[model samples]
Target: MAGKSGRTIANVPEKSLKKTLFCWEGMLVVLFILINVFCASISQSYQFENVLREMPKYLTEMFLLFPMAFILVLGEIDISVGATVCLSATMTCMASNKGLPFAAVILTALLVGTICGLVNGLILTNFQELPPMIVTLGTQIVFRGIAEIALGSGGSISLTNADGFRMIAGKVGIIPYVFFIVILMAVLFSVVLAKTTFGRSVYAIGSNRLAAYYSGIHVQTIRLIIYTVMGFMAGLAALFLTSVLYGANTTTGNGFEMDAIAMAVFGGISTSGGKGRLLGGIISGFTIICLRIGLGQINMNPQLILIILGILLILAVLLPNLSARLNVKKKA
Candidate 1:
C-alpha cells in the first residue's frame, strides 16, 4: 500500500484530485488575483494588452521552469541553464547572421543546448561522487566562457535575418504565440509528472535514491533525461528570447537560472525534493511575472525590484518549513 515516495498509494488519487483545489495552489491563486488588482491599481497602463506585450520577454523563462521542476523533483539542480541559454542564443544569432536558413539557425540553437546538457549528464553520471551543483557550476562557467570567446571583443551578435524570429514572436489579437506554447508545454509537463510512472520514479528517487534503485528504477537514466531536457528547454527559451531581442549577447541569459529556480521554488516546488507540483509553479510563475510588470510600470528601480523578488524567495522557502515545524509541534 505504500507508494514509491513512501506515501500511501491508496490515498494518492484522492489527494491528486483535490490537489489544485486546495492548499498551496489555492493560496497562490488568491495571491495571483490580488497581485493583478494591485498592479492595475498602481499603474494606469497595467491593462490587458500592455501586460501581454511585456509577457513574451518574461515567458522565455517559463520554458526553463518545466524541466527545472523535474530536476528539482529529482533532488538535483542545474545552475548552468543560464549559460546554456547564452550559448544557444549566441549560436542561433551567429547562424542567422551567416545567412543560414532560418530552420538551420533554429536547429543550431537546440543542438548546442542538447550537447551542453549531454556533457553535463555524461560528467555527472561518469563521476558519480560529484555533486550536481558543483558539476553544473563548472559547466556554467565553461559554457559562458565559450560564448564570450565566440563573440570576441564585441561580446554580442545581431540577427541579420530576423524574419523567422519575428514570425514566432507574433501575436494573435492581444496574446503572443509564446504564451500559447507555454500553456501547451505546461499541460504536457504537468500531466507527465502527475500521472505517469516516470513521474512517480522521480519522486521515489528524490525521496530515497537507494530505495528507488532497489525498487527497479533507473535512477541515473532518469537524471540524465531530466538534465538533457533542461538543456533542450533552455535552448527553446533562447530561441524565443532571440525573437524578442533580435540578437544575442554574452549577458543574454544572465541571472536566468536564478530566476527560473526562484519561480519554481515559489510555485511550491521544493528544492529538497520529493514533493510539490507543476501547477503551483505555473501559477507562481505568472504571479511573479505580473508583480514584476506592475512594479516596473510604477517606475520602481530595477535593483529594488530584484530585492523585492529576493525577499519573496526567502519567504517562499521559509513559510513551508515554519508551517511544517508548527504541525510537528502540535502533534507532539
Candidate 2:
C-alpha cells in the first residue's frame, strides 16, 4: 500500500505482514485539526480566503526547504540560507535602485546567489575540512553584514519594477504565483529525490559518506550541485519576497533561515540526517502558517505563537526517536 498523501486505507493487502506507518504524519494531522478547531472556537475573523492566501508563502518556504531537505537527507546542513536570502534580495534592490535595467538587476541577483552558493559548494568539496554548519555560519554573517552596510539603516527598498513585480504578489483567479512555484518545486524535488541518480547519491551520502565516496559517487561534485541548488532556490525566494514587498532590503528574508530549517526539520529531516520526506515538509508549512493564523484569530500573543511552534518542533523531533527506541526494545 502507498504511504499517506496519495493513498487509500481500503487498498491495503491482507497478506501483507506489516504496513508502513507514518506516526509523524498522524501528529501533523492532529496538529492541523487542533489548530482549525482552536481557530473556529475563538477566532472572529477567520475566512476561507485567509487560509488560501497563505499558500504562496507556503510554497515560498518550500522553494528553499526542498533542497535543504535533500541536503539534510544527505546528512548536511546549511545554516547560512537566511543570510543568503538577505544578500540576494539586497542585491536585487541595489541593482534596481542604481538605475540598472530590471532584467539586468534580476539576472544579477540570481547570479550573485548562485556564486555565493558556488563558494559554499567549493569550500565544502575541496577543503575536505571545513564543516558545512560552521562554514555556512560564517557566510551567513558575511552576507547579512553586507546587507547592513549596503542598505545603511534602510529597512525596505522601493521597487521600480513594482508593476512587473506585482504579478507574483498579485492574485489571479484565486491563484497565487507563489503557490504555483511551490507546487512546481515540489514536483521537481520529488522527481529529483525519487528518480535521479544524483538523488540516489544524495541518500547514499546521508546514509554513509565514506561508503558513498568509495562507491565512485563523486560525492564532492554532488555536494557542489546540492549547495548550488540551495543557493539558487534562495535566489528564487528573493525574487518573490522582492515582488511581494515591492522592494528588497536586509530584513526582507530575515529569520527565514530559521523558518525554513524549522519546516524541514518539522517535516521529518533528521538532525542526524538521511531520513525525511517531501509530504512532511508540505505539512510542516501548512501547519506553521495555520498555527500562526489560528493564534492570531484568538488574540493570542504573537510571542506565544512562537513558543507554541517551539514546542511543536520539539515534539516533532522527539516522537520519531522515541518510537524507534521503543521498536528496538521490543525487538530485543
Error of 2 at 323 (Å): 1.4
Instruction: Give TM per candidate.
Output: 0.94, 0.88
Candidates' lDDT values, in order?
Answer: 0.93, 0.78
Please estimate how well model 1 matches the true structure, expressed as its whole-model Cα lDDT: 0.93
Q: State the displacement of the C-alpha of residue 251, model 1, in Å, after optimal TM-score superposition.
A: 0.7
Model 2, residue 310: distance off in Å is 1.2
Question: What lDDT tens digits, residue by residue, belong to model 1 across residues 96-141?
Answer: 9899988898899899999999899889888989999999999999
Worst 10 residues of 2 by lDDT: 13-22
- Which portions of model 1 miss their true places by more than 4 Å? 1-22
Best by TM-score: 1
Scored by Cα lDDT, where does model 2 land?
0.78
Candidate 1 RMSD computed on C-alpha atoms after optimal superposition onto the true structure? 4.4
